[model samples]
Target: MKYNKTYIFGITLVATLGGLLFGYDTAVISGAEKSIEAYLIRPLGLNSLIHGATVSSALIGCVAGGMLSGLFSNRFGRKKTLLISAILFFLSALGSGFPETLFFTKGEPSIGLLLAFNLYRIIGGVGVGLASAVSPMYISEISPAGIRGRLVSFNQFAIIFGMLVVYFVNWSIAYGQTIEWINDIGWRYMFASEAIPAALFGILLFMVPETPRYLVLSNRDEKARTVLTRINADRLRAESILFEIKQSIGRVTERSSIYSYGKVVIFIGILLSVFQQFVGINVALYYAPRIFESMGAAKDASMLQTIIMGFVNVIFTVVAILTVDKWGRKPLLITGSIGMAIGMFAISWLAYNEIIGISTLVFIIIYTASFMMSWGPICWVLISEIFPNKIRGQAVAIAVTAQWAANYLISSTYPAMMEYSGALTYGFYGLMALLSALFVWKMVPETKGKSLEEIERLWKK
Candidate 1:
């Protein structure tokens, strides 16, 4: 079958925009942390609990969004649902950025005001959640089987790119500013910057066609044929592709227990999702600045270091994209898990002994690099590819919801945990990393270059 490079690249870009939004939303909060703590906790007199809740509000939305994306995408078409997610992203950015002004902030501790801000963050979180589940799914469905892993990996690449961009934006905004100036206005600008990408995402959504699987599922055969033709570039192959989708849909519907698959698949998917988070990658990404601060760097220096971490993340994600097909998924997971465990153990020892110098930074960079090349991008690629078409949407949704919930738990608890046991936290994550390696060794199969049908057959057998 002849491949249309232009169509593939265009669709990949649209789907990957969700990654951009994900990266922007996730990392944008880092810059706002100091200002948010100052205004709400220090000056406004809110306690640590409330301040922490406020900070992690977006994650709550992420869980809810991920939980619902499967249902929404199944009911609406993927393209429409993505457009709806874009709307949510735009609103969340605006609401989160100017919460006090958008809603009614009477003075200091207004319950309504707090809830309002959190609600906005949740709205954006939902967008992230939907994108997380669907973007790769969309990419997977549309891509040629031979190149599916590499193309779907573009989603993770976009996410890391987004993270890197925001880090640079954050650093530039706070570059020469004093603590007072940063606390006063700089953070708000950081949150507001999300609006640019959010708008871009919305515009791009219109330019892409709906997934052919989705159109076929909805019985819009002509539209599905058209999409398949444009995407696949051969009438005969397009019809065959459409027929395959129909067969999958028919098999799924014939089962009286389609919903039960969600239960079993969701359990596995959620565990994989949760384990990924519990491994504590975000603790490194989200709190890099604070972690550097703990290592005796000034705020500006710490922010600069966080940017460096982002750069490392981007570079290694490229490495993963190149090698994921060549090396296969299982080996990457095993290698990453081992590397992460070792890196974490070393960092824990450094922090535990108060080895305050360049060595500590070097180790953290190694840890981040290890993650980007393996679990960071490859996990999403595997999840996107491994599930059967019958339960792919629902299963992936469950996994993503579990991931966000785990992310919230890890992010929210980290501060207090650090206060109580700094080195112990790293030790705990290192242990999890070792366990992750064992899990992969025992359960994960190599899915490189296999079609979805082939993967499903191998798993069922």
Candidate 2:
């Protein structure tokens, strides 16, 4: 059946906005962490540990979001769940930007106000959490099998692009300001910038239809046929696709348990999520400027360096999107894992010798580029593809939840680990990267060129 490529692209673009917000909400903290530490932490006489907790508090909400995504998405539909996330994103952005405005006196320091700020950030994290799981799933279900990988990879591109956008916004905000001024007010503007995109996503989401799969699941066959024909451009082909979806789903009362798809499929999905985070990419993202400063780059120089890294991330993610369908998933994952291992190991060695120069920067770029190309995008593509439709909702929730938990564990423990030993801290991530390569090589099935229904049959074979 012939389909309208432009129409498909437009839907994909709108869905990936959720991905952009996911990236924006999470990485926005990188630029604001120092200000937060100065304004919220130091004022309260808190230590680095508390600062780490504060920085990662949003991830706690992420876990809750992921845990609840299956139930909410199953009940409310993906579009509505995403709409809910958009509202959360908007409110969190405004609240985080002006935490002291509501209750505390302006410029006054207190633990209560800090808690309020963390609460707002956590609310945004919940949005990130929901978007992270639902965005890719939505794209995958809607996209054609031939180009699904490419379309879903766009979500990853959006994630990195969002990070890049915020990096620029953060740098621009602080480009000429004194540290005193930046800490005083510049950070708030950085956080506030996200509100524009959040509002846009919410408004545009209303324009797109609910996914055909969800409509079919809910017994809205007429609506499902409408969406499918719009996407497929041939009523006969749309009906054929709908028939396949219905056959796969069976009766609604016959819902499969989480492990019904076969333990290997579920395990692989969880590991894909886990390894994506355990590779320590978030550490690079969440602390890009600080990592540079630790290498003796001044604050401004570190922001520039972080911006450079953000560009590298965006470029490599584009490479992944272009090649994911052509090159297949396992190859990219394995190759990227090897690249990350080498990069991480080299960085660990340099950090151990206290080498801070272009060499360290080069390795950081290599590591980030590898991740952006491989685990960064492919992991989401696979998770969205691997699960059987019946179990996809709950299964994705579990995998996404594990991913956020792993993200929090690695991100939260990073400062303490670095304090213990820079060599060991990065070396650990390097080791995980190596293991990730082996995991993909041994466990992950090749998913390219297979429809979601086709992929599900692999478990039985």
Candidate 3:
């Protein structure tokens, strides 16, 4: 039966907005961190401790959000939980931009104002955490198996596209502006800019239907049938799919334990999340300008180079979306791991010899492009669809929780590691990249073209 391509795409786009906000929230700091330090940190005479905490405070919220996602998602439906996240995003954007609103006087930074700012960031982090886990899960549950990889992969594309969008927004907001103006006034606008998309996401979400899988699991069979029918355009085909979903669990119960499928499935999901971060992708993203500066590129040139890298990331992610179903998950992951390792090792060698030039740029692009094509998107693809339906929300929460934790651990430690040795720093990430390939090659299942029910049965073995 022919699927309703237009209808399926419409909802998928709405879901991916969550991904866009996730990227925007995380990377928006890169543009505003210096200003945050200047406005909030210096005025209060706080040391680097306060400055670092203020800049990365969102991760604290992210950890809490990821930890709580399973509970929220299981108790509430996915759509409502996502709607909650959209609200969080909107509030965080406004609160982060105007922490002094209706309370502290403007331009007067006190310890209270500093704490208030961190609180707002943590709120946004919670939104990032929820969106990070739920967006892909929602996409996977709705998408047909044949095209599921591409559709879910689009969420990652949205994430990268979001970061790129923020990068441009930050640049435009700062360009030709005085540093004092930027610190005093411009940074607020950068944080506030996210409100537009968050409000848009919240409003648009109401127009899309809850996923059929979620509807079925919640025992709303008739509603599930309707959604599936709309997606499939053939009532009989929709009925068949609904029957498979019902048969998979024999009932609608999200209360089944995460260990219901045994520990291996959960472990695989967690490692996929960990490896995706431990390979040092976020380091490249969160510190692109810093990394380029370390290579002696001027400030302006580094920003331009970062933008160029963002373009490369988007292009390569598209490659993954196009090829993931056709090439299979394992192949692309393995090929990309090798590409990342070679790129990282090349950079390590160059750093060892104290080399900095266009070759460094080339290798960095190679490493990042490889990541965007493989682990960047494929990890989320696997995590979303890997677990049995009964335990998906719980499993994804645990996995995503580990992901945010590992992200914080890796990203925070990069500066210290680089101080110890740039060569060794990249060498370690390169080694992790190689091990990720081995992990995928041996353990990660190739989920290409398999229905969620079909894939679930594999764990029963």
Question: Which one is best on lDDT?
Answer: 2
Which stretches in model 1 have alpha-carbon errors above 4 Å?
A: 105-112, 256-266
**TM-score for each of the candidates:** 0.95, 0.98, 0.96
Task: Give model 2 RMSD, 1 decimal.
Answer: 1.1
Q: Name the candidate that leads on TM-score.
A: 2
lDDT of 1 by residue, 376-431 (tens): 88888877877777777777787898899999998888888888787899988889
lDDT of 3: 0.89
Task: Rank the models by lDDT, top first.
Answer: 2, 3, 1
The residue-by-residue lDDT of candidate 2 on 272-369, one tens digit each, is: 99999999999999999999999989998999999999899989999998999999999999999999999999999999999989999999999999
True-structure RMSD for candidate 3: 1.7
What is the C-alpha local distance difference test score of each model? 0.82, 0.92, 0.89
Q: Which stretches of candidate 2 lie over 4 Å from their true place?
A: 102-104, 251-255
Candidate 2 clash pair list:
none
User: For candidate 3, lDDT tens digit of each residue in 1-461?
Assistant: 38999999999999999999999999888778778878878877876655556667888888888988888887897888899999999999999889987365774777777778888999999999999988999999999999999999999999999999998998888888887888988889999999999999999999998888888778899999999999999999999999999987674255486787789999999899999988888888887877898998976677788888889999999999999999999999999999999999999999999999999999999999999999999999999999898888889999999999998887767766787899999998999999999999999998999999999999988
Model 3, runs deviating above 4 Å: 42-50, 251-255
Q: What are the per-model C-alpha RMSD values against the true structure? A: 1.8, 1.1, 1.7
